[model samples]
Target: MFSLKKSQMFALIISSLIVGYTTTMINAKADSGYTVVKRMTGNNANVAYHLANNSKNTYLWNGIHTKAKANLRKYKNYSWRYYGKSLILSHNSKKSLYYYIQGITPNGNEASKIRGIVWHSYLTPGINPNYKQLNNIYYRYFNTDSEYLHYVQKSPSQKLTREVLKLFPNTHLSIQLTKAADGASPWAWASPRVDGYKNILEFPTVQKYFNKRFYKPNISDNTRFKLIKAGLDKSYSQTKRNALTQYQIGIYYYNNPHRLIDDEAPGFTIAIPE
Candidate 1:
C-alpha cells in the first residue's frame, strides 16, 4: 500500500469525521423512531392520520421527491441517503384519516413526494396512554400521483380560539384556574355540558365545534389538550403532567389564561400562588 501526502491525510480525516457525525444522527432518529401518531381521537372528531396506499421499499429521504423522470446516467435516480425505510403515503381524499408526523423537512421540493405517511406497523403504539386511538386500517395501496403534506399550525388555532370565545363569551376559565390552584390538573377539570369529565373527554365536542367553526380540521383532541398541558408544564419536568411537580404550568395559566385557549403562546400565569 502506498502512503498518502500530509494534505490528503488531513482531508481524509475530516471526511471521516463528517461521515461519522451524520451517521450518528441518522441512527439516533431511526432507532428511536418517532411518536408521529398523537393518540387523542375525540368522538367523531378528525385525527391526524389516514390510511393511504401501502409503501413498498419506499425510501424517506431527508427531503421529499417522487420518482422524477431523469436520465439515470446524468443524475442520481434515488436519494443517496434516507432516514426511514419503506415510507408510505396517505390518500389525498378529504374524508380519509391521516397521520401527523412531527419534525419533518418542510416545503416539499421537486425531487420527491412528501413522506408524511409511514408504515403503520413501523410506528410504536401506546406511547400516550392518556388518550384514545383513532380508527384506521393499514393497507398497502400504491399511490398513482405525487403526495402533499399538510398540518395544523398555531396561528390558525389561535384564530379559531379567538372566534369561539367571541361566540361563547362565558366559559369556565376562572373556575378551571381555581381548580388548578387547588391541586387539580387543568385537564382534570370538567364542565357542565360534560358530566364531571375533563381534559381529553371534554375536548372532542370542543374539537368538533372548532372544526366546524374554523371550517377546517383543527388539531387533534389529544394534541390540543397536550398543547395546553405542555404550556402549563413547559419549564418543569419534561415527563410528569402533575401541577405540583411543575409549578410553571400553574404560573403559565395564572398569567396567560388566554394561552390555554390560544394554542400558541406559553406562559406561567393562571394558578401560581402569590
Candidate 2:
C-alpha cells in the first residue's frame, strides 16, 4: 500500500467526487433495444442493402428520405458499430433500390438518411421495421405528429384554432374524435404537420418556459423542461436535436394531456399503438 499526504488524499477524494458527479449528470439512456445495425463501409454497402431488403417489408422511411439532401453514401459517413434498421423504399426497380439508411456516427444514437438508388446487391437485411420500437417511436412523434393522440383542454379555449387557421388558410383544426373509416373504432386528431406549427399549438407558458433557441432549459424548469431536454440531448447532431425536440414536446403533451388547440384537419391517419 502507498502512503499519501493529507493534501494528496483530499485531492484524490475530490477527483473521485467530481467523476461521480459528472457521470450522474450525464444524460445517459438505457439501450433503446434497436439491435439490428451492422457496421457498414463503402466496400460493404452493396451487401448490406441487399440483406436488408430480403428481410423485411421495407417502406420508404419517408421521414429520413425527405431530409437526405443527396446520395447518402457520398454525403454522410456510416458507422458499423451503431446502426438502426436499414430500410428499402417502396419503389424498387430492377437496377437499383432506394434506401432509408440508419447512419451512425461517433455520437451514440443512429442518424437517419435517404440514400438514393444503389445496386440491389448492396442492401443488407437487419431489424424488421415492424418490430423496430425505436423506429415506431420516431414515426409516431416525428413522422405522424402523434396523429391519433387525444387531448383535453387545459385552459379555456383561447381560440388557438382560429389563430392557427389565420396562418394556414387551407387548414382545419378541431379536437373531436371521429369514427374510423371502417367505423370499427374512433380516433382523435390534434397534431400539426406544417412547419413552425408547434409553436402555435403550444400553450404560451409551456412554449415560453422551454424555448431552446433563446435560452438553456433543463429539468430544473419542471417535467416539461426535463422531457424536452432529455429528448433533444438524446441526439448529438443539431438537426436531429431539432427533429427530436418535436417528439419531446409531444411527450410533454402526453404528460399534460391538455391542449390549447385540437386536431380536426385530416391530412393523414395511422393506428398507433400506445
Candidate 3:
C-alpha cells in the first residue's frame, strides 16, 4: 500500500480536479467558441420589413439553423423583433450576420407570438417600401397619422396623388394596404410566383396557431374545388375598411412584430395545406 504525506495528497487532489475540469469542457458550447451570441440590451431596430434585395422571397426561421429547417415562412408582416446586436460566429459557416427577432400575428395576441432568427440583409428597418420609401417622399393623405401605424395616410385623393408626385419628383409615394385580422389577397395587388416557396405548409407556426384555432388558412379557397391562387394580400388603409377574408387565396407567408406602422400586409411566401 502506498501512503502519501499531507502535502502530497493535496497535490494529487489538485491534479485530479484539473483533469476533471478539462474533460467536462471538451464539448461545451461556450468553451468551443462556436456560437458567440452575446445577449444585448436595447435592440437597434424597433420596426423592420422583410424585403430581400436580390432574392425574390424572404424567409423567417424558427431558430438559428445552419441548414434550412422544415419550418420556415416566406414572410410574416410584423414578425421581426430585433433581439439586440446579433453577430455570426464559427458555429455558423455561412459567415453572414443574423438578427434575432420575435414574430407576432393577428393583432399581436399572445397566442400568435413567436421568436425567430433572420438574415440581416433580408430585413430593412422602418416603413416597408410598399408603404413608404427610405430616401424618397412619403405621401400623407390624412392630416394626422394613426398611433398604430406611422407615416401612412389612407384614401389619397386624385388631387393629393398629383400633388405628392409633383413634390417628390420620381418618388412614387402610394397609399398601400396594411391589413390586420382579415383582408383579401388580390392577384392584381401582388406579384404571384411559385418558383421557390412551396414548403410553407410544413412550417411549425401553422400547427402552433392553427391548432389553437386562432386563425386557419382562412383565405385561400372557399369552394371545395381546391383552388390554388396566389396574389398580393392587401389590407385597406383604414383599419375598419380592411375587411377580413376567411376565403382562400394564393399568398406568401411572412413573420414580423415591430411593424406597428401598418396593419400588416404583403409578403413573398406562399402557403398550402399539409
TM per candidate comes to 0.23, 0.23, 0.31
TM-score of 1: 0.23
Deviation from native of the Cα of residue 191 in model 3, angstroms: 52
Off by over 4 Å in 1: 1-4, 15-100, 103-115, 126-193, 196-259, 262-274
Question: How do the residues 106-194 of candidate 1 rate in per-residue lDDT, one tens digit apiece?
Answer: 11112233443333433332111111120110001101111100011122223323332222222222323322332122243353222
Better of 1 and 3 by lDDT: 3
Q: State the displacement of the C-alpha of residue 178, model 3, in Å, after optimal TM-score superposition.
A: 19
Model 2 residue 10 distance off true place after TM-score fit, in angstroms: 52
TM-score of candidate 2 against the unseen true structure: 0.23
Segments of candidate 3 deviating more than 4 angstroms: 1-34, 37-39, 43-45, 53-57, 66-73, 76-79, 91-94, 104-111, 129-151, 155-274
Worst 10 residues of 1 by lDDT: 134-143
* lDDT top scorer: 3
Task: Write candidate 3's Cα lDDT for 41-154 as tens digits.
Answer: 453454444444523544444444443321224333333445565656445353556676665332332233455566677766543333322211122211222311233232
User: After superposing candidate 2, which stretches have Cα over 4 Å from the reference?
Assistant: 1-142, 145-202, 220-274
lDDT of candidate 2 over 23-100, digit per residue (tens): 643322221222222323343331222233333322222332332233333322232221232333332222223333
